[model samples]
Target: MMRVKPSAFVMLAYLIFLLLPIYWLLMMSLKTNTEITSTFTLWPADLTFRNYQTILTDPSWYMGYVNSLIYVGLNTLISITVALPAAYAFSRYRFMGDKHLFFWLLTNRMAPPAVFALPFFQFYSAFGLIDTHIAVALAHCLFNVPLAVWILEGFMRGVPKEIDETAYIDGYSWPRFFVKIFMPLIASGIGVAAFFCFMFSWVELLLARTLTTTDAKPIAAIMTRTVSASGMDWGVLAAAGILTIIPGALVIYFVRNYIAKGFALGRV
Candidate 1:
């Protein structure tokens, strides 16, 4: 028999417990609502893919995915672009209230999303950005940019000041040195930061649902309207949940090597 420690078994059990709900959701997606409600089993009594079929064929359903991707992509790009310079500044310089300013930035991320929802909605409405993908992207940036900066700053601090000084001594312009020499050094931090940005924007429902009606409705919002006179469509709801997890999984797969290094410092 293979040897195993008591702690190993405990960890294995915890892993199974955590994964059981995901496995059950997959099982439920392959079942009909009637089969789902009538019995309880580890596997579906009648396995069918009609729930996935329904979502794939419906424009409203698939468009939810598209709209979500658009805004999430936009938000990630916007956050990283803005945060890179800010993170570099905080990492390299000692200026007035720098530490306090950094803490204040995190406070934006710390605030409850619901607290700002009404104000964001009103602000976007006045700018003619309501019910658009950009509106949702901008709203998410309120929180994403701060988090990106904080994480990136940690990674940047791990870099030595000598690199910046040497680049300047070589007569490289500031922008060129930052782009050519500096960014490549902190690539892992950027990957981790982008991963977080994508996840937060992808899973966020409060601001996304509140800001858009039809034109920019996200998959998270679309999942809510499956209720009917008969009742909620459990099969479809489970299917939607399964699909929503795929993008995040893919992101992690690509960034698996860098994630640990990305969060190594700055109290991450």
Candidate 2:
């Protein structure tokens, strides 16, 4: 008989620990609220997909997901577009207060979203941007841009300045060189940055909740509908949660390679 290694046991246990909650949520989603609240079973006695059906059929429920995706995509696009040039400058040039400015940008990322909640609410209200997808996307930029810059700058610094010189020597204009030559070199970094931006904008509830009302409410916000005067809808809530996990999970799967490269080469 072969002996199992101690590290194998440890890894198995760690994976189980990480997977337990997701397993429980899946089981709960398949169960009725009565079964959930009254039973102690590890698995559902009668599996049903009514919870998922409801969310899929309900316009209000499904639209929340649509709203979330819209803002998240917008935020990722804006953050990457803004960060690329800023990061390139940081990696390629040195100006007075450059270091100070870089640190200051990071300070913005470090600050809690709650700290800017009221200010953002007030600012957008003045501009009549409340309950709009663009409002939430722009608000998330306050955090995501700095983070994108930080990560992109790390990857940019790893690139040789000789590349830029060679491109210029080949008669490539600044825009052409950046778009055609420079960006491909840092594609992994962009993927990493966009992944982080998407994740942050997707999962963040506080600012997202505060900044939007019905017109642009996120899936996370819509998840709150599980609570009612009758009590919580555990089954529906669990199903919604599982569905919400799908997008982020898919994104990670697609960008897994780039993210691994980011860990090795960039700030990630």
Candidate 3:
């Protein structure tokens, strides 16, 4: 027989405590709403996937997922595109008020999303871009860009300034050096930044909900609107929750190595 250490037992218990809610949601998703409400069990007495079927088949439900993916994709692309050059500048040069300017950018990230929701809504509405995926995506840039710049700046600073000087001496243009040389040097930073951007845009409820109406309502918003006269649909809600986790899981899976490097290197 093998013996377990006290530390191992403690870690195991903590892991179980953290995972219990997720396990419960998965179990509930597999059970009928009637069975869920009527009984308490570690596992479902009778399992059914009707909740998933209903969500998949319903336009109102499934579109929420589509809408979320649209904006999240846009946000990631925009954040990376803008942050690259900005991070390069911050890393390579110092000017009057450069540090203060960088600090101001990060302060935008620290403020609550609620503070900007109305301003974003009004601005997007003014441009007739409300209820569109790009609207939410652009609004997210205000927050994600700042953090993306911050993260990328740390990685860029780790890179030697000699690389830029050598690339220029070799007759490489600014755009070519940046695209072909500089980007690869800090790819882990880009990957980590994109991962955060995708997750934030994916799960964010307030801005995604407030900036759009029916057409671009994200899955997070759809999850909250599950209430009906018959009472909240717990089974479908649980199924939706499970499905929502899948994208985050996929993002982490693809970026796992880069994220590990990011932590090891240490960034803001």
What's the true lDDT of residue 224 in model 2?
87
Model 2: per-residue Cα lDDT over 1-268, one tens digit each: 9999999999999999999999999999999999999988999998899999999999999999999999999999999999999999999999999999999998998989989999999999999999999999999998899989988999999899999999999999999999999999988898999999999999998999999999999999999888999999999999999999999989999988777766553954
Which has the better lDDT: candidate 2, or candidate 3? 2
Candidate 2 displacement at residue 89 in angstroms: 0.4
The full ranking of all candidates by lDDT, starting with the best, is 2, 1, 3
- Backbone clash pairs for candidate 1 read none
Q: Candidate 2 at 129: error in angstroms?
A: 0.2
Compared with the true structure, all predictions reach lDDT values of 0.92, 0.93, 0.88
lDDT by residue for model 1 (140-246), tens: 99899999998899989989999999999999999999999999998888889998899899989999999999999999899988898889999999999999999
Q: How do all the candidates rank in terms of TM-score, highest first?
A: 2, 1, 3
Pick out the ten consecutive residues of candidate 1 with the lowest summed lDDT: 259-268
RMSDs, each prediction?
A: 1.4, 1.4, 1.7
- For each candidate, what TM-score against the reference? 0.96, 0.96, 0.95
Question: What is the total number of backbone clashes in candidate 1?
Answer: 0
Report how far residue 72 has shifted in candidate 3, in Å: 0.5
